[model samples]
Target: MPVAAKADVVVVGGGPGGFAAALQAARMGASVVLVEKFDMPGGVHTSGLQGAANEGVGGIHTELMARFEAAGYIYIATEETLPEWTGNPLSHYEKMKKPGDRFSRSSFNPEGAGSIMSAMLAEAGVEAMFGTAFLDVALNEYGDGIDAIIVANASGIQAIQGRIFIDGTGTSELVARAGAPFVRGGGPQPSGADWDGRHRPIPGGLLWTMSGVDFTKTAAHQKTAKDPTLAKLIAEADAAGDIPQGLYRPRMTGKGVYGEHYIGHPTLDMSPIEAPDSFILWQNVPYEWALHMDDDARDEARAKSALRGFIDAEAQFLRKYVPGFENAYLTNVGRYVGTRDGRHPLGEYIFSIDDAQQGRSFDDAVTSPMTKTFFWDGFKRHTFQVPYRCFLPKKIDNLLLTGASLSFSYETIFMVMRNFPWCTQTGEIAGFAAARSVEQGIGPKELQWDQPYF
Candidate 1:
């Protein structure tokens, strides 16, 4: 096959991780090429319509948020407002009607974020090949390093050669294709039965937004609306076939939404983003359907098709039943469903939940100690650190792992570190390591972990 391009580092899957990896490497004076399946970067945050960043400490994440704010592309809720709004519930309804505090917890315009990603990559002299899909890898003579990757795009099948490759595919697709060992079926199950694809991986969801919603009326109704009444409407919708079949229960995580059980009251479920009339929402699929992710492509496609059906049904139901959504319409649907967990390429160290809960630290730490922010309200908010060894594939000499594909066990730790900010941090570390490895004429594993690189 013809060689499409050559660079010092080649990054696959231009999501948050891959995008940061490519950008950082190029900025470090390495020739970089980033390949993405979609037309834009930002992965789930863009194409998947997951436009929110709940937490960010430093690094590219904070910088990106600053740019988004300057460009008028984001809505931010500060740390102080975060607690106050959660306390008063109705405060979110009022606050969201106006501008937010600053860029702490943020929701952005996905397209605008994508444009920013493109501009950053371009400015750093990185060749970003969007609309390109990874096909396979070409191994070197020793079978320990990748010489190039085979890809397909509108330009047809071609090869992208690089000295070092980073896999941010979120499913460890590159390492899997390179014949490296990885943990699958929700990571280190005891019965060994889950590895056979019998058990579901992490729960996956699809996000979409609706415009022309009346938040004022929705908030007023939420103040006195009874759960029994909303549940009855849902039952009626199901009876009338307005709701999708096979348990189409969706929950809201957007602005102006009150309480955790917003699923019971669909009117209070949608979260406002960018504008008061615009809101983002998501729905979790059945366990049987979620099990297909990264294992069976055909089945995954079927699951997505079912999700689209749910989106249509829910949109119609909101317009007909909800008081505030009398004329609500679907503003946009995500390009694809976002998978939370999948294949994890095994590394020298598999960061486990125990490590996270204990707030373990290592000499080879690549990331600053991060707080325990995922799902567990009761667990102590201890800080955990990620080491550089977690990014190195055990069998692949020239490949590094980032994003959800990193060598972390599936559980609370994955949920904590899998956010866009954390993923970008991992990418920053990996990119720096790859560029240094190329410059020093050594494998990534041989490099000494330097704290200043972070």
Candidate 2:
């Protein structure tokens, strides 16, 4: 017989979504249990090596940033002072700003993010079980509520029961395990029909980071002059067949410090479930660079080969074309790929692209000002709300899901659902709702979607 421990609420998968859910539930006075496969929290933001938080979903999301700032973990990107150009105005005109300055967006350090998230979870006093994997969910005899969850840890399989459960797993593992209906790759399985009856898989994506950069020197180089050779090289690289067009953009995380160049490639079928560690690269290479490599050695070789190509190309560009980077080095790559789309649960409300574009605010809006979908493209911005119905499955009365796997359409996902902050916001709402439902002694489905909370 397994030891059964009960809690007011149970949250599985300790990523940003799970952590926020657990923290918010505990703060609301619920005895919450947060289970994570890893030893620490912050999911992609910490372990995955995804770069810093952005300013989108405010309120609780803003509070997370405050904690990081209060802990001396925040940094600002500053503009470089450019030197005066000589000769014709266009002849020696200086670039004035770093490559990342093409867009005005805030960025942060991953190390800082990890530190602050760990601190926040510790301060919240939520009972966290790290290095634990959720095996199966035991349903009530009526098949309406989740009676207990079986998890495998170092000790063995333990059955933990809770009045309410929140699934923060990006893959919706809990919801699927509980026998709830779900759709992977942007539509229903087998047919892949979306809400509007279109076919699409959840958009698969990747994120890589470059290191060995001299921030100060790069800033200086940008300010001193614009070299035509460098511009040509950039244009040439942009035209490369493997590189995704229009997805390459620079993001500065710190002032005269670290930065990132985002390359969004949708054709690469590197799903989170299939290639969790595929994003860590030592260099920037063609998207099909892994096609010929052996399956067993692909991951390792991809990192090395891609990184070498990236560094060498960058070095040549900086030395011969760009002004700075004469001594730039390749630093570290991301630990996990920055996934944009994945499997989502089938729920009562499937948020669509039309809803997102129209700025449709739900009557049961858990959080206000659900903004538009902000994808890799720098120019597009859309605001939309996440209805409470999206959190609960139509059939499952006890289980709730949040994060990237929430109920939404492929068009909606492509439009507004890809935002990470929105996922965090949804997570917070799901946690609060689950706790409230448990305290009220009602099935999660019974909670009014019109006005989620009294």
- In candidate 1, position 361 carries an lDDT of 88
lDDT of 1: 0.76
Model 2, 244-287: lDDT tens per residue? Answer: 33233332232110111222221111111111111122222332
TM-score, model 2 to reference: 0.70
Q: Per-candidate TM vs. native?
A: 0.87, 0.70
lDDT of every model, 2 decimals: 0.76, 0.58
Off by over 4 Å in 1: 54-56, 77-105, 187-197, 223-225, 247-269, 288-290, 374-378
Error of 1 at 320 (Å): 0.8
Model 2's C-alpha root-mean-square deviation from the true structure amounts to 9.1
Model 1: per-residue Cα lDDT over 204-285, one tens digit each: 7677898887755654554567532256567877899777665444443322111132222233334557665677877655
Displacement of residue 104 (Cα, Å) in model 2 is 5.4
lDDT of 1 at 262: 20
Looking at model 1, report the run of 10 residues with the lowest lDDT sum: 254-263
Error of 2 at 252 (Å): 25
